[model samples]
Target: MVEQSTRATDRPLPLPRANLLHLLEQMVLIRRFEEKTMEMLALNRIRGYCHWNIGEEASVVGAVTALTENDRLITSYRDHGFAIARGTPPETVMAELFGKEGGCAGGRGGSMHMVDIARGYFGGYGIVAGHLPLAAGLALAADYLGEDRAVLCAFGDGATNIGAFHESLNLSKLWHLPVVWLITNNQYGMGTSVHRASAEAELYKRACAYEMYSEQVDGMDVLSVYEATERLLRRAREDREPSLLETLTYRYPGHSYADAGKSYRTKEEIERWHQRDPIRLFQRYLEEHGILNQGEYDLVERRVSQKIEEAVKFAEESPFPSPDTLFKYLYAEEGTK
Candidate 1:
């Protein structure tokens, strides 16, 4: 169980109207993009292991918005939202999903590995807990180079029980590496509920073993997530402190395209969580604060719809990578050919 001291219940800072609008725009974009992705998947435009980040837009946008452009971000396979939030063009992301040559990864990575290094968004890892050590290494390299950047590594709750998670945290704390482990505790790790899989479901407490600063935030609330991430990221950048932050969120869709998501969870439970839908909650907040009127909301929706349509068109227009180029970028040695 996570200790009380590590739980974050502080009220979020007041967000400027412009900033709130920006956050809302990003959230809306992610929502629409994910919806479009589902449509494409249903139409068989995208194949293979396609994981959608439909219900966790708040966590993705909030944490990523807190980072500087120089900071690096790595995440697990449910990464479409993260890539979009971190500045990867929707067209490029859609193309990648379509397996076209214009993709961010040259159409090779597809949905599970959207990468935009120039934007500081490292590609997503398909293996659970595999990127933790790589994140630590990135932090170490940044420290060695005297760079001020920090690395934010995001993973699911399922990864918390893995050995790599512990090993990476231990080394990060010991070396004072500038990294923040953002665990998106969406309750169910794939299909297994936290209660069934974890002995200590409050995951932030796991950091206690490494003597690191850790906290739990209301992942359903975008402001809460953003504030906690901002604070923790500041510590990492200024003091080289490694921290663990668990955001309690949920996924509305199935774990993947294969699972129905209803086999393990009840309709009531899904509805209860949807009551706190991040996008809707944020939209209500904006409306209550007089920042978003119906007209503005509709405008955002229209804009996002158009953006996704353009992205789909771009993906359709893009050509597939040549079969002859399959061996390209596979080897480090230049003379291998």
Candidate 2:
């Protein structure tokens, strides 16, 4: 990651009208929904491992919006917002997180695997580097199936260090798979900075080694993310070439709800990132463009609050999956039996 900004201040990124509002709404929804999840987790209403993609709202909103409906998406465990933005109903995601029967994976797949294949979401993979290869397989499958659709594999900076990431990218290039690797490098690889763990913190350069076209973008800027993703997605779809995008973003909350702002991160660092929050940035753009007034913007926020309330309500009122269903979707069944 080269520094595009130095001693001089850089211009604040801008967004257009409709897209600006849409991005704002999505970020609000994600914020409200995740806040609800954290509340639920604190109350012990939702069990199992839960990771929230809070501060990385811009990356989720912008990248998913720029993708085609048919383009496949595969992301890591911190995927509540990712799934929702990919058009998976909040109710399903909430229910899935709550482990209810109506959840995306029939209540079985919890936070780490709420995949709606119908929407082309491959999964919320739990294993760190496990899904990278799976996504490469998906891209190769698309090529073999002769479909124009491309696979969008979203992973974190941590996975970049894993060997599967390297092997997967090698294969993706070798086969000319139509795919785009969207690496959300949120500064911290777990609790350590990229520089702390990686000798060469420029992770995008890994793409260049494979001759894969790559670019680094300010993940806090939704417009910049959208533009870059739009271009990358267009090229992947049009040329069947694979690309890699490194989103230099930050996570507002600690690594997980259980984390207590450990020694690795400081209050000032978190506060600094909060200043350029994606939600506020987009809302400001909407107001400046005169597309939405304060009242209208308040409506979006209120709607998100209500929507998240209903989603939690729906999950609360729903039933958990029966023990019999445990073995149902797990493996192949009865035609041979």
Best by TM-score: 1
The residue-by-residue lDDT of candidate 1 on 214-261, one tens digit each, is 998878778888988988999999999999999888999999989989
What C-alpha lDDT values do all the predictions have?
Answer: 0.91, 0.84
lDDT of 1 at 96: 96
Residue 56 lDDT in model 1? 89
Compose the digit string of candidate 2's lDDT tens values, residues 185-205.
888877889989887798888
Taking all chains together, each candidate's TM-score versus the true structure is: 0.95, 0.94
RMSD of each: 2.7, 2.7
Q: lDDT score, residue 131, model 1?
A: 94
Relative to the unseen true structure, what is the C-alpha lDDT of residue 264 in candidate 1, on a scale of 0 to 100? 94
| Lowest lDDT block of 10, candidate 1 | 1-10
